[model samples]
Target chain A: MATAADITHIACVVYPGYDALDLAGALEPLTMLSSNVPFQFYVVGPSLEPVTTKVNASVVKTVSPSFGQSIAPTHTYDNPPEKIDFLIIPGGMMFLDPIERQQPTIDFVKKTYPKVKYVLSVCTGSVILAQAGILDGKRATSNKACWAWVMENCPNVNWVAKARWVVDGNVWTTSGVAAGMDGMFAWITQIYGEAAATVAANVIEYDRHTDASWDPFSDAWRTTDPDHGKSVQPKFTE
Target chain B: MATAADITHIACVVYPGYDALDLAGALEPLTMLSSNVPFQFYVVGPSLEPVTTKVNASVVKTVSPSFGQSIAPTHTYDNPPEKIDFLIIPGGMMFLDPIERQQPTIDFVKKTYPKVKYVLSVCTGSVILAQAGILDGKRATSNKACWAWVMENCPNVNWVAKARWVVDGNVWTTSGVAAGMDGMFAWITQIYGEAAATVAANVIEYDRHTDASWDPFSDAWRTTDPDHGKSVQPKFTE
Candidate 1:
């Protein structure tokens, strides 16, 4: 059992054009867990330089001319900590770009996944995990707005269309940006118990969606892709 | 009417021990508005040094012994831009501290409020606005968890308990951390129109609380202060 004294190190993977909310929403609840569970959060990127998001480009331009909010990473992929208990990856417009363009991030995820205790992805972050071949045979989900895109690109995973969050073994994936909070709260509940999760949510006054299956977004944003209902066989069925 | 060419510069006030969600939740939706409306966001702090939050102390300690996630502020209070169109203030645990302790931030609020066209506050951020004498004759709301503390401290403002967000002229205030998203969405609707607001919410897959009067948290965390019901007369009642 993890006690208050046992520190859990969570590495939040960030990159340029990443969705700020995907990382922020998940961090909000996770941060609230600090009082009961001693933990650390490291904003890891490809480098220690300031990273930009998809939003506030004009503001970000003033500071870095290239990045958005000027978030300085504590550690780079090359200099990550020896141990990472939790790995969180957030998605953004960059997710739609070619996989080769994000080779460094995908490589980091592949190298780090086996050592981490748990893996979590927000929005299209699952796409990155899929590209890394981690979610090969896992049941996962992605942002509802981009569900069809994921279904078309990753044909090796059993992607569920109706779920706020899908937890297959140690890997957890959420739907869209705000849904990351629900997934993080649910993940906390699994690790820290319902009481701890409840306390964390209460601190932020967040009415967390406790039900993993209660996702209304999948239907709200209907994907016309005929393959949307098709279940792709897992390549690594364990 | 504001066009895409009309830029709105938003100065987000941040500090050590600040609530990550208060600023993040608001920024998520506001940032989404950038594609349709040109806006710039500046993370302002006392200096360019990293600001710490209450959570993930161990991880934050690894990077900087003094702060949590290292947020590199683009501008300082002293070196702020000449024109700030919008002002955003977020709250955290240290909100209840003596006003004298945060004199610089309070002083900045007092000095900047008049120049900004819109002033938005999240959670106990209203306390800072109140302390700055900006909410003197205006209506506002804050995090229900710290409702009594705010009421006791800022007795000169007309504080509304049953509101997710309160809009008095150009100033907007939200209930808690997550509620800032709702407030930002509402603010967008007011400025950019319903279609724009809807697009922003849909992108995040966020089901925003559209009604300003739709807050149940105020009752859930009700305070027993006798002066809770007393509506303080606004000192700058227009």
Candidate 2:
């Protein structure tokens, strides 16, 4: 059993229009991990200001060197510290913009990945990685919603589908918001062993269904139908 | 089906030691709601400044305006111009402290309850409501882990057990963090009807068991304990 102190550094990226769950799902386990282990987490953004979520409820606070603020495991902290041991990128609506324009985020990712062994992404975060040329030929997945967009636009990448997670050596990616937890669990399992990961998932009552090694690199990726027309509320309510 | 503009106003409270799920769970449904419907959602704290979550996530870019920020929801640009149509008080680690201070939250709840038709609380947020004297002798439930605390500290409340959600008259409360989704679903069910709520819940893939009208005052609440910690996980390392 690992105590909370084992997780010393984790850095998360936040940008405007970020999906709340992608970040939250990745965090739930970490918060539990912190209770049993001692670690420092950071929410790094472009500026030392608040980044509004897509839903507008939760905000990711910036952590500047001069202004110190304390946010609990389940909350967002102000500007995070610069150095980190593990870095995670949770996707949102604006995840795939050209990295050239998103200099701050790309610079942060590029600078941190060489040092951090466990680098991860959720949903379209893989798109950002793709733009960064990090997953140029590696297998990965994003928000299944962006399946077509990624396949057509980012040809250098081998996009996986139906797979909850895609791991090629050290780099990892998840399918969507909910799947981020599964991906992170897999990462935790790799480092701490299965028992610890299972215990962590059990504590949060999360059920890991999709297989970790199942890569969707074939027809399986194309055969699935999109989750469109799922909204029941009439488009034009009478 | 709903456009971003369909929502007239939405506000989620931020305070110290607030439960992440209590906020995220409720926001999830509303997030989905916004995707389908047009609406404006805002995160408002007791003050206009940034409020940190219990999990150390800071919600930033917030304007901490007072109730007097605007007399009419239509007039206010920072927050709801008039009475908030939908308001959620997320359960946080800092519930009793606010009550003891008789801070703005207490006055806000008491003064606004008469106008706000739907007043929602997730997990221990109900404790805040109870402390505000709104749930006095009223059947409600807090986080199952904190049931004893709620009962012992807030004697005016009629604490219920073995129930995931409890609703009496206009007030709604949930058992724990995740159960906040159930409360939101039920609330959506009332506003849009079961067909809409059912469709919305299915879209989000929420595994909710209880329904509205499963009042905490009834014996049905005593049938089983969902939080008995029966959570299990895979032990295999492969």
- Clash counts for all predictions: 2, 46
Compose the digit string of candidate 2's lDDT tens values, residues B216-235: 32231222344322431112
The lDDT for every candidate, in the order shown, is 0.75, 0.58
Q: List the candidates' TM-scores in order.
A: 0.86, 0.72
Per-residue alpha-carbon lDDT of candidate 2 for residues A83-120, written as tens digits (9 for 90 to 100) = 56777887764423343444567666776677775679
Show pairs that collide, candidate 1.
Answer: A40-B59, A52-A68
Q: Which of the numbered candidates is closest to the native, going by highest TM-score?
A: 1
Q: How does model 2 fare in lDDT?
A: 0.58
Question: Candidate 2 chain B — worst ten consecutive residues by lDDT sum?
Answer: B63-72
User: Highest lDDT: which candidate?
Assistant: 1
